[model samples]
Target chain A: MTVHRPQPPEDPDLPERPGPAGTPPRIPEPLSEPLSEPLSRADEAPWRRVHPVSPLIRGWIGLLAVAWFWGQNWFEDIILAVEDPGGRGAPPMEGIPFLGGVAWLLLVGGAVLVLVGLSFFLSWRFTKYQVTDQHVNVNSGVVFRRQRQARIDRVQAIDIVQPLLARIFGLAELKFEVADAGQTAMSLAFLRLGEAKRLRNLILARAAGLRSAPEGTGAPGPGLPGTGFSGTGAAAPGSGVGPSEPAAGAVPATDPAASPDSAASLDPAEAPERVVAAVPVGRLAGSLVCRPLTVATVVLVIGALVLQPVLTEDVSPLVVLPFLLGAAGALWKGFSSGFNFQAAASPDGLRMGYGLLDTRHQTVPPGRVQAVQIRRPLLWRPFGWYRVAVNVAGYGPGGDGGEERSTVLPVGTFADVLGVLSVVLPDPGTARPLELITAGIDGSGDAEGFRTTPRRARGLAPLAWRRQGFALTDTALFARTGVLGRALVIVPHERTQGIALEQGPLARRFGVCDVRLATTAGPVSPRVVQADVEVARVLFLEQADRAARARHRHDRDHWLEENPHG
Target chain B: MPQEPVDPQGIAWTRVSPKYAAVRMAGWAVGTAVTLLVLSVPLVLRLAGIWTWPPLWLAWAVPLAVLALDLVRLSLIPRQVRAIGYAERSEDLLVRRGLLFQRVLVVPYGRMQYVDVAAGPVARALGLCEVRLHTAAADATIEIPGLPAAEGARLRENLTARGQARLAGL
Candidate 1:
């Protein structure tokens, strides 16, 4: 006879303890230090040791993350529990003298969960992070040690992530995104929420090549203990590192690691970072619930529940349907990722992070953001809400989290959109970004120094000919196209990887070609569709010149600079 | 700008050696005849045994469609070959191909990852080759086919030199 079993989503293959952190994930190993490399970083140097509580935040996400790779066996039990309200029945202990098979299995399952949690805890305890002036090193693994070093100078972006449970405990994970495509972003998980913020600031400072002095050591000072940014923690006013602004009021203890000994340290008092744009909690909540995807999901869920008993099949739609339909994941992901969205500009680039469940802190320095796009869906017109996304070099391993990779604005007003876009493309290649954008998109085509597809090409791009076109300025290329829904992609010449012009039978017959400007960052495809062939040729040649010039003009050794804005 | 017809002839088109077209046509003719024979076998047998009305029509339809497609392919060979050409500029390689789409791609020498020339058995028999240019971006590869083997090699060498001189840094 078969025994009944309740399972938690567990992948059979996911190493509860990944044997080698750098393996399957396949993060590119750091290049070996040169033979003539300079002095090694001091072991006692401040910024060498990670905050004490690194394990809690990372392990929390790791446990939840396992549900994905795990066989999803736990899902069936959730459905079974809800499907059958049958009260707990006595186990078949009557047959087997002491205990029933079900009881034993339940005990085993509980024990496994406890064991998994303990392992995550142990893993967190063992993991160590060191941020030197030149590199950020992550070391972990109980039996087999793995150390990952990302050069601070080469850091593409830094993301601080907090999963739902970790957020409750005021913890987060810092991810280092680098320039190498084959290399995986190095993750430093589960630091105290306050400590994560301080660490992010310090790393950015070093990445900017600001090697004035080392900040502080790993241990927290006596005056500022328990500064994890938890609401429960009593944060001393004016605590730890920063320009004195409490990080969204989540300032944990001043980074005990920032500068305990040096009089010149821990105070970025001169480090000028001011909040450029922040979405209100109310607005963020409104955006989540009112999103087109969310509303459709709610409707579908309600329908599924209402149709549950009437369904012909024995399987419940509640649990099974979400697996069958992708929208459910989209709904949860859309709402959870951008909650409490905030964007700030420091001497570096723009720092944006948000998540009710998994908080992500990503910094795109001045020269790295390849492209910026501001889109207003037709449905959003009346509400005056626009969504914005940017593309930065080295935002790796997001597979298809296109929107997640560069979401500067989840939902914001027109003014808010301008505020964010201004940060992304401060020098939007135009003297007047406002007028240029308005004319290009509104189809109010009274030529504000922009052009539309030639009339002959109307046959090729029937619906969008009037609106689709590209404009070249000295610094950037702007392309706008849409029939019902519209998009405007701005790519600075310096950031363009390559540009392509495509034509097919139909396009040739219609005497037009499509020009695509490829950038190394973001998912936006900047294409000028159905342009006159001659026009495309000229644009192609012009773009090559513009790109070469743009590269030299903005040749920045460091991504971060002192002040950013038009 | 004045309107100009999207014509491949306007550019000083580099014609692929006619011998290549002949070899391609012969290969296509044999492939088409084999596919038609395979498809018509059941119809031929069924008609021979049962003398069925449907099989009679089906038999002719297979050959007819095959004939039509083969003839179209034969007629388009020159145009397809003629449509492909590459122009090496001072700083970039300009590749033009396609009869219908009139596609043109300008790959900067700086972005060139590598240049490759492939000659298949049929192409080698006809002394023809295809030059492929690759950039870091995957989809940005430009392949120009049906060039004389000598010309393909020359283009490859030229592009390689330009790429080395202009390769961009990370």
Candidate 2:
């Protein structure tokens, strides 16, 4: 292995060698290296496979599901045979008289287990991936082979994932969040945890346009096609239990979607590649408990439980079942999705990673954030804690309501919220971003140039009447509304998709209107509802002006010096 | 003498075609008649001895109920048409509409992905076309109705031109 210092692009005078005609072209890694040499088709690049144990780890869920089905079938027959000696329906073992029910059950369960295990092993052998300077490529499938390549420049975020099973073996998966609106994110699962971390850093460094130099250390970690086959599955010892190595020629395989167990042994948690900020576990738990939705769910459950005794015997379980499940689901979702929230500033923009059993890594570029919402629930106001969520392009609505993945700050102080927002929006081009943000958050209508809803709108929006207002700066539009859970969304004009004004019969009669700034489908909704009609109209026009000037700067020569005349 | 309270926002307003009010009202009338006819046919046929299982007068209930709603919509169409307005700012397009719960939407020309001009049978007969503009946001589709066909085309061309210019600058 050689230590290669990153270099700038080479001079064009050098000779360039082209690869073989028929094979895939060898794309060079970032501009740090000289482009004088052409990559050889045969050895320069090749598809790589994951760890041999990957298939079992990836396919473990399917295997267990099959085993569970078989186990349930036998358990019923065994129970009947043991309890009801002379039942009307004969037990399953009756047909196999030589072996009693117990023996038959073991035989079938073992056979099914072995068959499923073998299939997972074979499936793992087929899946493979490769990373070039320009793109990260994955070639996968057993029956229907498929190849996917995401350009390095378009990579939005990369998540390092460790499912319980993979975690047990000290393995991690690299999940790529791309900026292609129509495509689903890509995942390279089940690599050595150390290797996964390094790959994440290497890929990010390249994607940030700081392309690393030509081949140094030469090893494509442990998972490239040829290297993975030769590297001993020593990491497998951590989870594979038995030390019996597979025969040299046996094809190794991998799987995904494993159900993780509770914390068995917490490794003195490895430092996040670059920790910017991490939400304390205690704070996360406290915030989840105090959240309005969490409290409402818990109260509903308790109320239902209290009524359980009065309901008839048949209705008792029905009443208890759904309420208990609903309460548990909400609490678990709140805790798991937000657990261990960590935010770090990277060259690629602000990077966030959260989740308990199924950890996710999301990288949001600066320009990709369409809007930002800072919200403070009524209960959270006492403690000055807020939640931050953003609308990001190409991320899409995959969660329950696009809330789960879009959450950048599940819980934070006023300062933490602004810190995260700064990373996303960077420069609102205002002299006092902090003042604008704070005024937008808890400030009254009189603060700055924020104009509130009219007194006539009082009856229309009785709860949020005076609170509804909008303040615009050169680069951002701030819309403040909501009585109980006050929300202020700051949208940069360049990112604004469209602005709309709405009026209902009552609002029209009140002589007020609503103006909403629409962004892509995500958590943050930037809208000023029930503003004085005149105020809304002015806002509409002013926003257009600000957005246009801001857009001219953003879409035009952003790098060039600012124009003095305009 | 005190003047009426001033409109604070002060955006210049451009009203929709005056003929559009009658066209919209007529449209509501046609829609109501179609709905009533569909509902009344079953009962009318049963009463005339074409069918018997379901009673005839029950069908009349729907049209009668529809009459009240249709009457309100038809009467409100004029106010709604008069209320609709738009203003073309230097960088974005502003559209305002609705009588009671009024709405004003500002769509920057650069953000507009495309512009569509659509006129159904009724609108076409009135020589008016609805210009619908789309932005990247799923909910940010704005429609400007009751524009003369020529005006709609001209707006579309101007919008496309602006969209290109802004995008190039970005």
Question: TM-score of each candidate?
Answer: 0.69, 0.70
Which candidate has the highest lDDT of all? 2
The superposed Cα distance between candidate 1 and the true structure at residue A77, in angstroms, equals 17
Q: Taking the tens digit of each residue's C-alpha lDDT, what string does model 1 give over B1-170?
A: 11224422233444556566776677787898788888777677777786555657777787788779888988997766666666666776666665655556666777776788998888888788888887645556878777788888888888888778766543
Cα lDDT tens digits, model 2, A1-566, are: 11122333444532222222223333222122321122312224334556656666677677567666777877777667666655434544565433366686787666765665556555655566655666777767778877777775566556666777776666678777664442456777777655565456545545544432222212121111111122121111113321222232221221112112101010011112223345777778889778767777767778777887897777654655676687778888888878777665443466777767766666664467888888998888888889888877556655422466678888877656655665676666567666767777887766777888888668877777777788877677888988788898888877777777676766667777777888876777788877887777677666767776766665422111223125
What DockQ was computed for model 1?
A: 0.36
Cα shift from native, residue A137, model 1 (Å) = 4.2
lDDT for each residue of candidate 1 in A349-390, tens digit (9 for 90 to 100): 666756665566667766667777777776666666677877
- Minimum summed lDDT over a 10-residue window in model 2 chain A is located at A261-270
List interface RMSDs for the candidates, in order: 3.6, 4.0
Model 1 lDDT at residue B99:
67
lDDT, candidate 2, at A462: 79
**CA lDDT scores, all candidates in order:** 0.60, 0.64
